[model samples]
Target: MTTAGGRPPRRLRADARDNRDQLLAAARAEFTEQGTHASLNKIAQRAGVGAGTLYRHFPTLAALLAALIGDDVDALCATGRDLMTHPDPDEALAVWLHAVAVHATAMRGLVATQMAALRDRRTAGALAACHDAIRAAGVALLDRAHHHGSAPAHVDIADLLTLVNAAAWASEQAPDDAALLARLLALITAGLRA
Candidate 1:
C-alpha cells in the first residue's frame, strides 16, 4: 500500500491491525469448521466486521489462506531443514511425511484449495509460493531417502504429496479413527521402500 504521494504506506493503524487480526482468527476457526469454501460473510460476521472489511484486507480466498497458513508452512519447512541433518535419512523422511499429513489433515480441505490455487493463474503468487515451499521441503527429504536407498527413485515430490493428500482426506473422512492418520502414513512410508 502507498500514500497519496506514492511513498510506502506506514504500518497499519492500531484499529486496522486489530480488525485484520480478528479476521484471521475468525477465518481460522471458520476454515477449521467448514473448509476453505466457508462463507466470507460468515467470517466477517464472526470477526465483528463487515464483508467489505474482509475484502479490503484479503481480496481473494487464496490470499486469505496464504496469510492464514504462512506460519505453519514456515514451521514445516524449518522442520524439514532440521531433519536434513538426522543420521537416518529414511526415518527423517518418514517423520516429515507424517508431519505433512498431520498439517494437511488439520486444515480440513487444504489439499483441494492448494491444488486449485496452483492451477489458477489468478492465484499465482502467494498460494504458489506456499505450495513451492512445501514441495521444496518434501523434495529435500525425499531425495535424501532415495540416495539412502530407502525411497523409490521414481516417486517424485508431487506424487508423494498427492498420495499424502489422499491419506489426509481419508483421515478426515474417518475422524473417529484416532490411528487412521498414523496408519496411513506408515503404509505410505513402507510403500516408498524399494
Candidate 2:
C-alpha cells in the first residue's frame, strides 16, 4: 500500500506490524471459537489495539478471515517436520491428523469468506500454495509411516487426508469427540493394515 509520494510503500513500522500480527492472532482464536461473527471490537481489545486500528488493517471481515486462514494453513504445514521427529509414526500421524481435522472444522463458516478472497487472484494463489504446503506435509507423514514399517504401503495418503477432513467436519455433530475420533482412526488404521 503506497501513497503517491514515490517513497517506499506505506510500510508498517515494526511496532505496527507487531500490532497487526497481535490483532490477527487474537482474531484467529476468536474466530475459531465464535467464527467470523465474533466481536471485532473484542479482538482489538484483546490485541491491546484500538478498534480503529483493526478497522484500518481490515476494513471488512473478509480481509481479516483471509489473513487468519492463511496464517493457520501456513503454521499447520510447518508442523509436518515436527511430526517426523516423533518416535512413533502411528502416534505422529494421529496427532497431525487430529490437527488437520481441527483446522478443517475451524473453518465451519469461513468457506464463503474465503470465496470472496479467492476472487482476488493473488489471494487465490496464496490459498492454493497454502493447500499444497499442507499436502506436502501429508505426503511426508505417509512416507515417515512407511519408513517405520507401520502402515502398509498400499495405504493412500490422500485417503487419510480425506478421512481426517471428514472427521473434523463430522466432529461438530458428535457428543463424545475423543471416542468418535478414536473409533474413526482405528477403522482407518485397520484398513491400512489390511
The estimated TM-scores of all candidates read 0.91, 0.62
Q: Distance (Å) between predicted and true CA of 37, model 2?
A: 7.0
What tens digits encode model 1's per-residue C-alpha lDDT throughout 1-194?
78789999878889999999999999999988888668999999999999999999999888888898889889999999999999999999989988888788655866445754585656658878888899999999999998975887888998888888888888888879989988988898889874
Please tell me which predicted candidate would have the highest lDDT against the true structure: 1
Give each model's whole-structure lDDT. 0.86, 0.72
Off by over 4 Å in 2: 1-10, 13-30, 33-63, 107-123, 175-178
Best by TM-score: 1
Off by over 4 Å in 1: 1-10
- Report the poorest 10 consecutive residues by lDDT, candidate 2: 109-118
| Candidate 2 lDDT, 1-194, residue by residue in tens | 45578676877899989988999889877876775478999999999999999998887765776677786777787787798898888778777877776677674535333543443556655455656677789889888888784778877776787677666556556856657766776676666655
Score candidate 2 by lDDT: 0.72
